[model samples]
Target: MYVARDCYEQGVKDYNSSTNPWLSSPLNFTVSSTQNKFVVVGCDTYAYLSGYQQNESYTTGCASRCESTRFMVNGSCTGVGCCEVDIPKGLKNVTLESRSFQNHTIVENFNPCGYAFISKQDTFNFSIDSLRTLRDQQMMPMVLDWAIGNETCNDVENKSNYICGGNSSCQNSEDGSGYRCKCKDGYDGNPYLSHGCQDIDECQDPSNCNCPGQECINEPGKFTCFCIKGYHLDQSAGVCVPNQSSLQVKLLVGLGTSFGTLFLITISLVLFNAIKKRSETKLKKLFFKKNGGLLLQQQISSNENNVQNITLFNSKELEKATDYFSENRIVGKGGQEADRSLSIYFLHSMEENHLLDILDDRVKKEGDKEEVIIVANLAKRCLHLNGRKRPTMREVAIELQGIRKTSDGQQNYEELQFSRSEEIEHSDVSFTSTGSFSIIASTSSSTVLPLLPFKTI
Candidate 1:
């Protein structure tokens, strides 16, 4: 490293610049001038540079002139506002001085003083503001060329004082006054001491090779690339690529496709079930409207609290509502009844012991007399006026199966149920002007059970 003693009294004129010449180092080299430039900064001044290189003296100077800043460029140091000259090589001691051509009488308003220094050419640039101040800069940097005592490489290569280390070589200095040592190619370090040069591990940087899939092998001061298993280097692409035509790759692709297909099927089934449930709800609503259930619902909701719309119809009223057994209303073209004016008649047949009378002769054959009486008693309990007295479903099934013995006559009882199922579908319903609802259920050919509830359509 080389540093010039650079300083300037901002508003003063008398100053001098010089570098330490008596300094010594392990390599025994002095300050170098080969890498420095003699720089002069002023508008109407001249700067001189004097130095000694290997006992040889030299003197050089450059003059700068600029009237106004209008045409001055900042970085151009070509005799405008700034000027520079290459320093002589092998210079060990330097002195810089400056003098104003007209005592700064013309450009003093813009450039009050002049300056001269030794520095790297790139380290200094002239700007308009530099004329006013330098931001208190005191030191500037330059490059130094180092070498051993005054001797050529051949004069000391084989002597006991030779200093070139392993993997290094000795070379004469640029000024031809001394010699220097350097590490050879593929090696680097201080080359003046024993074992100072070391091999460079190029593999530390993988970019030494263009292939990433290949393994980087580090050799002494060098590197090589080798492909790993399941990979091969492609000459055209200049890179290692994995084998795509392998069974493992095919297996992965097949598994991905199968899972995707199953996901789609599961989604389709979920959508199908949602549509089916929505359609069922819509159908039930349509059937309810067609059966006058909407009007029945409105009548029930509009009634005062503790009010009900259900009305029971007697056997005579049910027969009238069915149009006295007209064939067209039963098994032919369906007709809507318009003559609907009915009086409520809740049946109390069990209290009157009229059980056998409600059974239709067309529906029931001559079954056992004992079974008939047993059935009549069950009906009385199921039809109890107080709902709390009514037998539960479990008790009803137990009583029917326990009280009666199994007989071939059971076939006749089943026949009676099947024959009346068709007649019970459209038994009879009547609505009065007061919005009273009456329904009669035909359990047999002639059996009429009043106020029988049915499930929603």
Candidate 2:
């Protein structure tokens, strides 16, 4: 029971339990002292717990006082900051009220409110912060003793109104009123209802298995543990052990274990190789798609006139020819600067009979210088800014073949034939295949040069 008072306003409140109905049922309801305790929390607080037992009145109280918060220890209810007292046995109803010496005016800034309650002992732990605020919660849980009626267990054993069901037993309450029902061993659940008690299967719970590596046999309300086949209980080791048998059986077991290990290792190696091959195939496909291989193939197929001798060098071949793109192998500045410089250098090198320096030295120098100059000039013309000023690569290829025929016994390199002159309608051009250009001719209305590094002049 709680005593109501205006804690937010200044006043002297009277304490009384006359309005509480709990006092009228003292014989049937007893306050549980073991389950609950009286508690009061505040800096300048005092609380009282008064009750009646067997027509006699009993009064007890506790005073909690603290000058500062330094004397408080959290989770403890001593007389310094918070206080707790155990209720007396056989006390049925109790009333709780808070009192202060000076209306908490001395420590009003830190603790203006006080709280008093009879709550479950296990659930109430004092905290120093509660002195400052209570968060609008004014009540706590309390336990009350309950029984069927005023009767001993033996007196109600054979009565027609006895509520204890099958598989249940009755025990006289400690308060001397009635009896409480409880299920028997190996059973659980509410005992007051018909068929409420149910058998417990210990073997069904994995954690209940006291015997490891053994067969657990379940029975009605009980279970048994036994060793598995081919094993016997080793009492000293407290575990199952294999039966001591002939040496031939042991030899076969060892052989089987060795075979299993080898089989696992073989499977692991096969899977490793399979994963590696799959990754490599996936990487090759990615590289091909990224380099526009399909687009190149489509262009080559469209050139029905002269697609012969067209070659697409793989990465390994091009890397070798360019000396792996080492700094020394680069002829000029990279990008557009290099593109322009390479075209000029190619023409100059050919006119000066130094063409072998740009091309592979492996090429035969037996070719005529006049034929080389004619082909070089045509490539240089393709570098024109205006396409109309430049002869298309097709026209250049036509002239290049005529010059090659004049130098008839020279070795010829395989070359790529362009689809149309429109493909070369830009100022920039790069023909890199095996790091050297090749010559090929096609009879088309458009002009384009094959195998030579060229730009529209």
Candidate 3:
């Protein structure tokens, strides 16, 4: 390196050395550009490096200067006393030339010469001692990069001539001019030779299986540690640990018992509620039939099309409507419909010749007297003691229609006749003294001592 700087006072630029790595036959290698640098070290020295490249020539240069050694740090290359330029990749050759100013005219006693060269980056140390002692060492070490063939890995990867043997992978040279071969993971050897790569017995190495006092078993490309009975491998720690099967079984049992108990309680509550509701519904239906609810429903159904839509209220509905039969709501049998109704009172009044007295004051004042008497007498026939003597709803309707047809004439109700007819529909007229109901339903009703108690619900 000193040869390039051994020159005149002003500047002398010439090639003082040449270095190349490919000259070593059978294993041609290139200087590792990534691992080495073109370095220049001196005060009042400027230098550059030149080399051949694939696309063009490559050149790099650097400069360093320091008035006194005290200003330069021992190992720092900050241009105070040392400078460096990076080597370009794929540089097969390195040449150094230099320019010297003052030529160490002042520091010539101790720092006699300037130095420039391509040295391995890791091995070079720039100390103050290096400035005076570097020349004593004539040779320097550098790293080199190597590969297998001139063709890239991709170009010959599948070809028969591919040099990578078994268990080896091909790698392209960093410079893009060739390729290299390396053993596959877990195998190591010269990958360029057939069967050169061999499996590494990791079990033999103590660091591979860190399970102390345990047997280590080797397998293809890897190893495992054998655990004793009632133990399992702790994957994270790579050690044998006691199994927790007993604890896990206890936990599962506890969870199952709790869930089953809660589930049974829930099912029992639901079943109790469902059975209670069903039994109440069945009892309600039984009482309804016992009270002759069937005949009431049939009568309603038969009359429904000919009159307004009808609604039948259950016991609960009726109780709610009258505020559970509060004493304040009681007026007469008409208002207290729990059992007897106005029909009973009306029949009693008619039998005693007190039909007119039972009529509402407003009805007596506004109604035609003849119609009142006719309707009252009809009601008397309807409440007849013999069920067979009672007129059908159709016959009742016919007689009522006949009364309406003859309303304008001076009616003679004293001679009114009773006759049965087959073809007359019932006429609905004011029956209830108050409320929206057309009529009241009674399961047991009669004023006259009857042949039987009729269920008229």
Candidate 4:
């Protein structure tokens, strides 16, 4: 049951009266329960009640007030002075309204207001002060229905509609309809136990059991167990203990061996890395000296004026930078070298075809290709059989330097003429007439060249 307390705490008064109309009965009823019906007492104010319901919508149940000949002597809403009405059966909610005849012009001085409600009868008692008093001294009690299941326990048990399981029973609902389920007596489990009820084991039950120095065993539908006179079950350990050791010495030995092997492998790796690094350093020094390291350094130091920038790189550095000398990094090496070698054969063939022109023109034309025939002419000129005609190493060096500077965009006619003059001064040996240069002994017994006339034939 539910009780609505504030339905009509204050009395409902007439609109024209000094009391507030908003506090009147009709507004109170609408504010209270929406489903419950109310009865207005103490005056046959039908028109006022009708207007109140019309304002609140008459579709809601109406209120009935007492006749005017019988005034509210006491606070009770009886037939003579108070009023009462039977609330609807399925009443869930309600509201109240109050109105006066002649707009309260007839009885406004004595009966300025009236009361209406659907309240419990015992809580409110009628009093004479209600006629002239401006307030209400009572609260309204309302009844609300509370139900259990929408289905009965019997219906649920028959159709297996309930969820409670394991040692339980169903009971009829206390309310008008439906039912509830609970565990059965002597069983501590769910009701609606269609799945099967589990029996309580009194021997294993903590509250009733006295298994001193014995084991309590739980059975499916019962329980019973006891330790013998000499033995007691260990409840804390949940198992029987035997006084025996179960360990192998070999296990410890194998674990130690595994650790030792791992340590040796780590040491071996460290020593191998150190040795490899030392070997690489020694190899780099060896290659550097073999590849004319000392000679290149001494040449550069002796000829500071002719020195050019030369960079020496370590093999490891080049290999690493070029991804270990990958094939893609080998530019102009394989096919290019083979093509150049073939071109030399082609030049030799052209030389055989026009030997005189190749010699006189100082340039060979081979298959519409302009080729320099300088190397053959220089070899012929340098390898004369007479001692006085071969070109000096100094003259060769100067001419080569002049040619290189000309390629570098340095156009010096004077330097070119000077290089040519030096070559001519030393060009005494004629290779076509003599097979080699003749060595001349000087006064100091050292080989030297005398100043000779520059001639070309």
Candidate topping TM-score? 2
Q: Number of clashes in model 4?
A: 36
Q: State the lDDT of candidate 3 residue by residue for 317-383, as single tens digits.
A: 9899878987645433334464355668778776677777878999999988766877777776776
Worst 10 residues of 1 by lDDT: 338-347
Write one digit per residue (lDDT tens) for candidate 1, span 1-457.
Answer: 2222223344344345423222232343545655678777778768777756667776788888888888788778888877888877766556666677776666756776766767775777778777656424455676667778889999999899998999899889976477889998778899977888898988787577656568877776567787877788898987888876644776888999999999999999999999999998898789889978788777777874434747756558978988876754642123534311110011344445554566668535776555566666666556555767877776777666654434433454456545555455567533221221111122222332222222121
lDDT against the true structure, each candidate:
0.64, 0.68, 0.66, 0.47
Each prediction's TM-score versus the true structure: 0.48, 0.49, 0.46, 0.25
**Alpha carbon lDDT of residue 335, candidate 4?**
36
* Candidate 2 wrongly placed segments (more than 4 Å): 1-27, 52-59, 101-105, 121-125, 132-137, 234-239, 246-252, 256-457
Candidates, ranked, TM-score: 2, 1, 3, 4
Please, what are the lDDT tens digits per residue for candidate 2 over residues 263-294? 99999999999999999989988987897877
Worst 10 residues of 2 by lDDT: 13-22
Best by lDDT: 2
* Model 1 residue pairs with clashes: none
lDDT of 2: 0.68
Off by over 4 Å in 1: 1-34, 52-57, 73-79, 121-125, 134-139, 229-457
